[model samples]
Target: MHWRVPLSWLAVLCLARLQPSQAELGGAMCHKLGLRGECEVQQDCMCLCFHVTADNSTLVDAAYFGELGYELILFTPLVHFYHSRGILRSTVGPAGSAPFYRFSPHHREVDVQRHYCLGPYSNPSPHMYRREWNFDAWIPPNLHEQYKGQGQAILGDGKPLMIVHNKYNQEWGAAPTNFISISTLIALFSMLKDRYRIVYIRPDPRQNLPGFGADHNHAEDFDDHEHLRKHHPKVLLFQDILQQQRNGTRPDLNYNELQLMLHADSERFVSVLGGNSVIASYFAGVNIIYAVKGSELTGHGLKDREFDLVYPRLGPNGKGTILTVSTTQHLLQAAANEFLQQQGDTEAGRTVLEASHRTHKPHRS
Candidate 1:
């Protein structure tokens, strides 16, 4: 559901009187409009709100009104709005309880399930809100003709499923899947929906940035799809790694190491770009699986050695087709151990080894 800042003249009057100062007015307006904290606020105070009720690009045009003195409010009615405005079957309730509403399917004997409730104090109460207003009420027959004529997209057979993976890269020993993983998922789902009579699978916890390094790099790569496709072939993978790295707060692996990893895995491995060398893999296509740590890659070895062994090959198209795991903790620990061992601090090396060992364990849900 989306909330629209009330745009009535009364609302403007309230705003003008309640907040005389520009700063206070801007702050209050933003808060009431449910805007993100980073939304650009020009000195002149122009603002536009967008609602992606249908197409993803529906909000693009609305975003360009930049006079800095106007407010744009976008409204998106609920999906069930049309389905909840008809004659509903009713049920009597216990004494003091609100009356309930139901709507059974045309040919069914049993009463329909109750999906919405109407309290005594609810607006348009009792009969209309409870007995007569069914949340699943059938669409009006006249409107059905119009709807069918509109040629709306139809959902193919089967249910939509979403897959969400967390800390996906830490297991692969390289980096995380980039925006390619997500964009690929979206593209593949769209295609599959057209042919297989299958519903779309929406994957979640998809990395947007691996960490600070990735965050910085993403700023550089923004909107330069051509540069990203050429210079950072696995740009999406780079974003995932950078996002994770920033989240983990790891400080090692500066820009040079990040660039090297990006270059190193351009064709096959999905490097998280910046941050540690941890990599994660995600399966594409139907019925995909996500690989967690310990299920694969047991026993100890150098960070690079382990990474080379675990990072899987991309498909013939130089794009990921299956899932993998990745991480940088081991590399960091290994580096610390090597430094301590070089200084002849055997105890410190041992301590680092133990700590690294513990770090590799999977976090419990």
Candidate 2:
């Protein structure tokens, strides 16, 4: 595992210590990473091209190229995971530092003019850590039409849909620190369960979906599945939805594909940090991301962080609203305010929770 840099000042210090011309900095940094003559460094501070590993990293990096209207050739273990999100040009490669061609899209493995080795972070490259994120060009395909309303059937209700995703695996340590608590969910659910058809999602690698796997090998520290089923019976679980879809006509739809279709049809999402949150931000909507700790909360400073400036541009119009919260209280407050339109101590807009199973055609992408 990569060493977790807990302090944000340390990153700032490293940047401050770097003293070189933009061109020299690029060349020096490249050579320092043992890419001396292999990669061509551009005159500008940013590299002309690069490759990234990991699911979220690949999405952000590929989207950067997509925004520039440049075709990106991705080599990822989860080929369909990226492909389902509208990344049509991707190839399968073994995970981790394995032997593979970096530039095979043009069949040019030798004498490549531009390409850089990107660090395994969500951002495209270490130098472009402050780069603006873009998923405006990655509008998900209209699979509802292709699959003949498989996503529409999943909506299962006429109420406005809200996608909720949470994670409870070990992150940065032995304990799971950043996750949406059950109590918080109950509180948020009580407020909006009547107004929205909540779809709770938590992907498990045990499902054995092709080109997809767990966030990491870390064991799950907590399970909210049974709790939600027992208490919030009206809330629709994604696994259940998948099983229903499997028994239907379009059983070929992969996990990622179904998720993309469902998300594209909805306008409200609630997710925790990690790849779940990243994926939720892709669709044009209001994404409430609860992240207590991580590089996302620390790096790039508080005023100009990626969550504030970059993540919002993930939508097609570059106008998606992403509200980041650090605590469960903040999450509940934001939900009540944004989703419920209730502020501080005001119980206005509270409605009785009612189940809605009436199927309707969801909005097309």
Please report the candidate that would top TM-score against the real structure.
2
Candidate 1 residues lying further than 4 Å off, grouped into runs, are 1-197, 201-365
Q: Per-residue lDDT for 1-365 in model 2, tens only?
A: 22223235322312233335643654564544333221223332122222333432221112111100011111121122334443223222211111121222211111112223332222132332344543322333222233334455666558878899887766665687877788777877878788788889876656554324333336473567888889998899988877777789667655666776688778788888776776676666688888778766666664326676555655545467888776666666566656776323345333211121112211111
* TM-scores for every candidate against the unseen true structure: 0.17, 0.60
Report the number of clashing residue pairs per model.
Answer: 39, 0
lDDT of each: 0.25, 0.51
lDDT of 2 at 33: 36
Residues 1-365 of candidate 1: C-alpha lDDT, one tens digit per residue: 22322335313312232324543544554444443221222232222222233322212000111110001000000111212322111212111111001121111112111112212111121111122222221121111112221111211123221222222222234444432244433332232222222211111223222111111111212233334345434223333444455456544433222322232222122222211212222111211222223322332323222223222221211123332223333432433332345446576556556655746532111
Model 1 residue 123 CA deviation (Å) reads: 20
C-alpha positional error of residue 102 in candidate 1 after TM-score superposition, expressed in Å = 30
